[model samples]
Target: MTIPGHDQSSYRLRLEWGPTGADAVRADYAVVVDVLSFTTTLSVAVERGIEVFPFRWRDARAAEHAMRHAATLAVGRFEALSRGDARHVSLSPASLAEVEGVERLVLPSPNGSSIAFALADAGSSVVGACLRNAAAVARWLAPRVADGASVVVVPAGERWYDDTLRPAAEDLWGAGAVLDALLHGLGVDAAASPEARLAIAAWRAADLPGDLLDCAGGRELSGAGFVADVEIAGQHDVSEVVPVLVGESFRDAATLPPDGPRLRRVGA
Candidate 1:
């Protein structure tokens, strides 16, 4: 189950809207991307030692109830935070924390949690990925592939009215480029698409720290006062932690020892 692009025979692509589509996805390795910042923020929080709990769009109230009773902090979009009128934290990592004893973060985002729930159901193992955690995800995923395991990269896009747009196309382009590099050992195909080519050019031209500040998602976070988190998220391969959904809780994949004797987990 190596990364998809490395072996074309084990790769397949699928497009979906929100968490509801999780049932349709069937893969061993799942990569969920919400480039606008949901997945980005989640990765940052988890890497910082915060626990993330994803809730369905329809089950937000239940999530809030569980959060309150469990004394866990709730973090999610204001729109889908609750069913009746309950409030939940916004999707800003700055608003969250890097402290201990803050148990349970009930997260529901337009793109992030919805996609997360879906992937958790369909994927044998679901991992969160964003531009901020791109290199880390690639390094973590590269050698995790089993002999014939299937992998799916679900990019949580934004919604307009009732329709959703692919999480910034630039995110998908950038992530795809990284995956291509790690798994396939191939540089992004400049001929793939104009948008992809441009992203690759920008990625190669500028230093990572500088380029992250200028990317579309980076600018959005900067404008939202989360520029620092964006910077932290953009640091490549800084942490060896790969977040995985375990039941109702999320934990770092690095904590689990490798199952077989052959493949060893690489990063911390």
Candidate 2:
């Protein structure tokens, strides 16, 4: 199961970027990191008991999907404000924290949600990973790495204005945060790709929480007056909830009762 140019060994515990990366690696488990907002927001929502559905984009069907699930369709910050719907703001992590009584949410993002949908469609066990729950995700996944199984960590990087992939530092560090825990804490003898190694090194060299604030994604979001969101996204290892993708949405991994379709092993 080796991709032509990619080393098969690296598939064990690899780190890759964007949706293309998620498509390239076939793993038993996938941890998607989009720290700037999508995943960070998902982490917060799941922590507050909200089930989040990752939609590839914000389209007309978004409203319909929300209606089908009896969930709220989150709008962009400006859209929310313009519509006088301040209660359920866009992808801002802080805004999501303040939301209540919403059992489900349809969260659309070009980066994070696209990757999530791609991985889920591929039948991979997907989990939303962020700085807040990196270590916890690792701990939850440690024992699941049975022999011959691989885990792919996809950092859902931002899209440039022109729609090209922008390898974001926030996502790299976020993936690295989880990589550090998975590799060290699990003590698994897994092969890591060059990108994976670089991520781990970056995490080791960085003042994680502080560096996250200064990353390009952080600065951009903070400049837009979501400074609190940036700060909230940078909080390290504070959340114990592992947002696992089950059915069409993400719920806390701990709550995914073990009786059925339990985190299916890759290809099982």
The TM-score leader among the candidates is 2
Name model 2 segments beyond 4 Å from true: 1-3, 7-10, 81-84, 259-268
lDDT (Cα, tens digit) per residue for candidate 2, span 1-268? 3477763344578877888778876678889999888999999999999999988785778898889999898887656656766685588888888887888899998788878987888788898999899999988777676456678889999888899999998888889888889888678667777778889887788786677778887787778677898899989999999999988999997887763245667556
The true-versus-predicted C-alpha distance at residue 221 of model 2, in Å, is 1.0
Q: What CA RMSD would you report for each candidate?
A: 7.1, 2.1
- TM-scores vs. true structure, each candidate: 0.68, 0.93
Q: For model 2, which pairs clash?
A: none
For all candidates in order, the CA lDDT equals 0.56, 0.83
Work out candidate 2's RMSD over C-alphas: 2.1
lDDT (10s digit) by residue, model 1, range 1-268: 2343332232332323244333444455666766556666677668767677776655648555564547454544334234333344556554554444555566666676777776554434677776656666666655554343445566565666657453465455445645554444532222232332344454455556666678776786688556766666565545556677776656677765664212221111
Backbone clashes for every candidate come to 7, 0
**Which candidate has the highest lDDT of all?**
2
